[model samples]
Target chain A: MLSHQLMAGLGLSILWINALLIAGAALRELAALRARRARLAGPLLRGRVEQGLGPDRAFATHTVEQVGRAADVRSGIAIHFSDRAYRSTIHGGTLALADGSRHTVPPSDDARSEVWIAPTEADAPPGDAALERAWSEAKQSRGFARSLDRSIREQATIAVALPREEGEATWVFDERFARDWLARREGLAALFIVLELAALAGATAVCFVGGSFESVVTKVGGALCVAWFLGVQPIGVALSEACRPLHRAPVRGAWRRP
Target chain B: MSAGTATHNAESRIFKHPAEMRQFGLVLTYLALLFAMVFVPATRTLPCLALACALSFLNTVVIHNHLHQGMFRSHSLNLAWRCVLSFGALYPASANIPSHNLVHHHFEDEGQPDWAAPERVGFKWHLLNLLHFPNVAGPHTFNGVTRWAALYGREDFRRQYTREMVFAFGLTGALLLVDFWATLFFVLIPQLYGARCILRINLIQHDGCDTTSDYNHSRNFVGRLFNWVMCNNGYHTIHHNRAGLHWSDLAKEHEREVLPRIDPSLDEPSMALYLLRTFVLRFTRPVARAVALAEQRASVPASDLASRAERRQSIEAELRAAP
Candidate 1:
């Protein structure tokens, strides 16, 4: 036979568990957001590379050629850069450059190549522009690039030349970014873990006290409210994370400028 | 960007994908059914338990589609929707991310790595495989998720997964507080059945199929009505090929790319008929044998498959040439 006391105890235990779970999720999100903000604030290259013409076409062409060469040996390389898309087959590789050059690279393992574009060239303002104007343009470009298609946003890697002689940085828009971002925020993450654990303890104590109350409705209502508040936020984070791309593009070149 | 356009955009933004609107409708229907089961006196009978089980199974399918292509633009709203959906379905979206999206998609039909690998059981005993799959696969799925979280240092995923576990168990406990028998009948039994059904569908999808071939790796059920109810999931080959394609676009992709390249045996007209043939009737017919045999025959080197006359001539020449 089930007793009312037993039921109340079970409800209280659940309420405490739900609260702990929610608190942990909230803390993780807080840490993730902080890390993301820090990453964005730092001087990192972020923008879509427009198709270069005439003399300004070296980087895109070189990258496409290298990508084509790599795709010959390997399968599943679908790259969309500038104005054209290039899908590689085992038989041959087709590279469509932004400068309206379409060429095929023969399939060979020996043909593997890499192309590295200097951050200064990729991000530098064309012609003669004031430093302020270049900086403003760079900022706008970053914002615009964020709104690009998910495939481009996820697959593209930006070359960044850090200020104050900190040297060049490679910013990839994939899972590695998350790992690297989180690695830099170890202190905040530790604090969040401790706070979550404390919240769990506090919730357990509150639930235990509430279970002893005379009114069953009051106990049940309080548990439901706690569950609702705790459950909703973390579940949202999980959904967002699920929608994230699972695949990362193969990185070829990493040559950085001095 | 006009006032009318802005309003329309805002309204449209409620669901990110067109398929999400259908998902939203399914979720609403599940909620209605759940409320009826819980609150309506007429629905409190034993048969209502069966109804709950069916509804829960549908919820799992809906959640599976949501896990692949999220319902909303905002991450928070999608997560919230997942949590609400989980209450009905009893399968956590957090677990689904690592298990279904990452591991299963990555290492599909690859035996140990693929938690839902139908080939784990002996070829002669597919029914046993279907019956025992959830038991064998459930641990692997959870273990895979844990291993992935640890390997990638995905603390956020770990925390969210923990939260889902807590929420599921806590909600069950809370429900038990109201009525023990009702919770047992409606929630626990339905949850168990839903979980089994989820695993069963995966087994049915990939069972006895070639995992190596690009086009014919998975069997596709082409029933229009089933695809509609299952969010075009019947177009399995296309889904596997273009995992990122929206569920609404799967039929079009299937027709365009997969239909020509894929072997005829790989495409089934109805899942119900396939299941009946494969499991219920225990049909011994081999649909993929001809394709598999052809693939095997093609894989052999031309030198190995040379005619007897050529082999004899080569042997005689070799013997004469030998000192």
Candidate 2:
């Protein structure tokens, strides 16, 4: 009888594992879609940086975090700015994603104050392969010919509305910051994966042992609270890791001035 | 091209090409092995199980080629063939269309992350990259495939993909139900091995290569007999360059276009030798360079496995720097 039950559970594991694979897969696609749509949802505008706006200006502090140089994190010096919008959004440069919202440059000290406008991809939203391909090519070139910032700007997935002129300040990578941020992202992702596994196990066991309705509901519910408020930020990081173009994110070795 | 090989509209015999016959024979041998494992109890030894796994791994290679160019001319026959191939590797064979052809092959053009880029894994022991890769890649491929099928703007693709999922799982599940222990040990292990090995191929073929260069984009394993066993997968550069070209024709094309321009280091003589040297011996030039750069940073690679508690211990440093 024990053998029979064990065998039954083994069979069920196979079925459930495949079920998880597809479910995990579906979640990933939804996350990538959310990533693309998140920007269009108006920047999650938590902070604003501007030129010498007096104290009490709403700073988008939530959007910017100092991540130490983790394994994948590139080491570079970070410079802090005093302007309200002049965030140290990583000292290399700040990536602004205001589609068709005229990327304003911080007025140049010289007469040649030029700003680069990101091409409008909002109308189509790269829904097809051809457009996605074009966006990918654009990413490859951002570091070469175009003078764009690192991080999101390098991806060219979103336009860096106002480009910063080079030689602004000598930059050095804060490994501590990049590593700190990466560790949090990876740690949170692993935590979320553990939570999902717990939920999967609960769901499987409840079925196997023949659960009462109330007990089943409580077990599964308590096993997973993905939409709940228990751990929202880490969960977001984890899901983002699943879909974000992490492997392609190339960090420059140095942006220090000659 | 379809008329030349396809039997649906021709007076010719089925699968006249030598490569065509080889693929069909291999698939038949795999099915026979599956039968023997369950029925012939004496064949259930360690060597036989390993043989089954190797054969199952080869099944993935066969399906890769078979998916590219259908072995059978008739659509229904091809579908049946696909169901068998899918079960052999424990995945929906149709997934290659999305995970491989659409994404990995079109790496440069797609402008998205190749699901299995080697950089995704960073461990001191390079072998760990091969193991940890599937954890990151499997979800990306399956997830990307779901989106690709829907956004692909084709109803047939959705239908076919769904059918494959059902058939592959249904057959495997039935076998498990028949005898769980036997299937788990004899059959399922081989199936899982095939799936994992196939995923690792992405790491083996592309790691550390200049992905942007036309001819240098992919490393090739050009051993003649090795290519015969691998169905000419060794000639990889030209395969990526001209994806639609049949596997049989890759050798000649590699000789013409790739051999002249490809870096000699990129043209490895054997996949087995390359893997043993790169992952295990650690004497390869790349490994030497990494060791030289961080002779004392043994703790660095392992830091990739960081935890919240471990990080929180450093929170003071984190907070101090966060102005």
Top-DockQ structure, candidate number: 2
lDDT of 2 by residue, B40-116 (tens): 76777667777888889889998888776677656677777888898898778988866776567655213435766
Q: What's the interface RMS deviation of candidate 1?
A: 16.3
Q: Give DockQ per model, in order.
A: 0.01, 0.03
A99-213: candidate 2 lDDT, tens digit per residue = 4232322322212221112212212222355433433342231211112232222223222222233543212122233334445544545556566556556655554454332
Fnat of model 2, as a fraction: 0.00
Q: Each model's TM-score, in the order given?
A: 0.49, 0.57
True contacts kept of each: 0.00, 0.00
The digit string of per-residue lDDT tens for model 1 on B1-323 reads: 69987856865788785557677776677667656655554665545656677767777877777776667888777767777767775656667765776546544311233766764333344555566556446655654555445421245566666666677777777876765434644566566677668877778877667765556567899988888887787898777656667889999888877666666777899888888788878735244454444334443333223332343344334323420
Candidate 1: pairs in clash:
A235-B79, A236-B79
Model 1 chain A: weakest 10-residue lDDT segment is A141-150
- lDDT by residue for model 1 (A90-182), tens: 122333433455533333221232122221222322233343343233222111111111112212333322232343222333234554544
Q: Candidate 1: where is the Cα deviation over 4 Å?
A: A1-258, B1-11, B45-48, B108-112, B283-323
Native-vs-model 1 lDDT? Answer: 0.52
